[model samples]
Target: MKVKGHCLCEKVEFSISVESKRFDACHCSMCLRWGGGPALTVEAENGVDFADEAFVKVYSSSQWAERGFCSHCGTHLFYRLKEGNFWNVPLGVLEDRNSFEFSTQIFVDHKLGNYDFANKTKMMTEEDVLKAFGAET
Candidate 1:
């Protein structure tokens, strides 16, 4: 599927080619702290292209990954793997959010106690996430 989206200030716009209509939520400490809650994202493993790259700023949040946001609006754009073409884009930024399905949650063990989702998602703990991504815990 191809999805188009823009930043809150409309200064940054992008389009992504995704293989699935499914999205995942990340409950890791970094993710939660970055967004002030779980980071609900959709994988754009196929490709992503930005219309106004200058409006976007990327922060190297980790050794293996980087996070991007709109410089003008501070809207989170994506969390991307530095070594690959894979990108996890925030679901809220997408124009057609109604078609996406919540399929999984990563770093489930790090999820806070204050909230929970009713969806039947495949949950993976921090350890599982580390192993899946070949990262040291």
Candidate 2:
């Protein structure tokens, strides 16, 4: 499916072709610090095209992944794998929120006790995430 989205200030806009409607949540420390909570994201592994690219700033958050956001509004955009063009766009930015399914949660061990989801999701720990992404633990 092709989904359209934009940043808070509307300075950065994008259209992504996604293969699945399933979304995942990341509860790693960095993600928590970045968004003050788990990042709910949808796999946009097929392709993505951005407009007003100059307003977007990408931060290399880890050795294997980078996070993108709007420089003007500081709205979180997407997290992308460095090895490939694989991208995970934040669910909050998408125009339509009714179609996606919560399928997985990564860094599950790091998730805090204060909040929980009712959804039965596939949970992965840090080590599992590393292995699944071909990264060193």
Candidate 3:
């Protein structure tokens, strides 16, 4: 499905022209710290465009990861890195959030004990996540 998303203030907006069901979440420290727990993420198939450059603040959170948020309201948007060739976009920022089906939960080992995903989602260890993404966190 075609998905469009914007920041909390609607000043920044973007559209993704691909199937949204491919989105996933990550529980790694960097992602959790930047996005307040599991980061709802997806790979922008072609690419994403910013409605306004000033709307998002990019923070280099780690050696391999960086995060983006709305500067106006501090709405966390994405956690991305140079993953070979693809960039990870936060699924929550998509306008049509329901279009995506959250399947796997990555980096379960680094997740805090207070939070849990014991229902049905696949919980992946750091090694498994890195292996699936073809990179190490």
Which candidate leads in TM-score?
1
lDDT of 2 at 3: 91
Best by lDDT: 1
CA lDDT, candidate 1, residue 136 = 70
Model 2: CA > 4 A from native: none
Candidate 1 residue spans exceeding 4 A from truth = none
Rank ordering of all candidates by TM-score, starting from the highest: 1, 2, 3
lDDT of 3: 0.74
Lowest lDDT sum, 10 consecutive residues, model 1, at: 43-52
Error of 3 at 132 (Å): 2.5
- After TM-score superposition, the amount by which residue 134's alpha carbon in candidate 3 deviates from its true location, in angstroms, is 3.1
Q: What does the lDDT come to for candidate 2?
A: 0.89
lDDT of 1 by residue, 1-137 (tens): 68998899999999998888999999999998999999999999665699879989999998888999999899999999888788889999999888999999998898899999999999999889779878776
Look at candidate 2 and tell me the lDDT of residue 6. Answer: 92
For residues 18-39, what per-residue lDDT tens digits would candidate 2 score against the true structure? 8777889999999999999999
lDDT of 1: 0.91
List the candidates' TM-scores in order.
0.94, 0.92, 0.83
| Regions of candidate 3 where Cα sits further than 4 Å from its true position | none
Residue 118 C-alpha lDDT in model 2: 90
Put down candidate 3 lDDT per residue, 1-137, tens digits, no spaces.
Answer: 45678887887887766644676678878777666677878777666677677778888887777777888988776666645445667777887777677677888788789977654777789899778768745
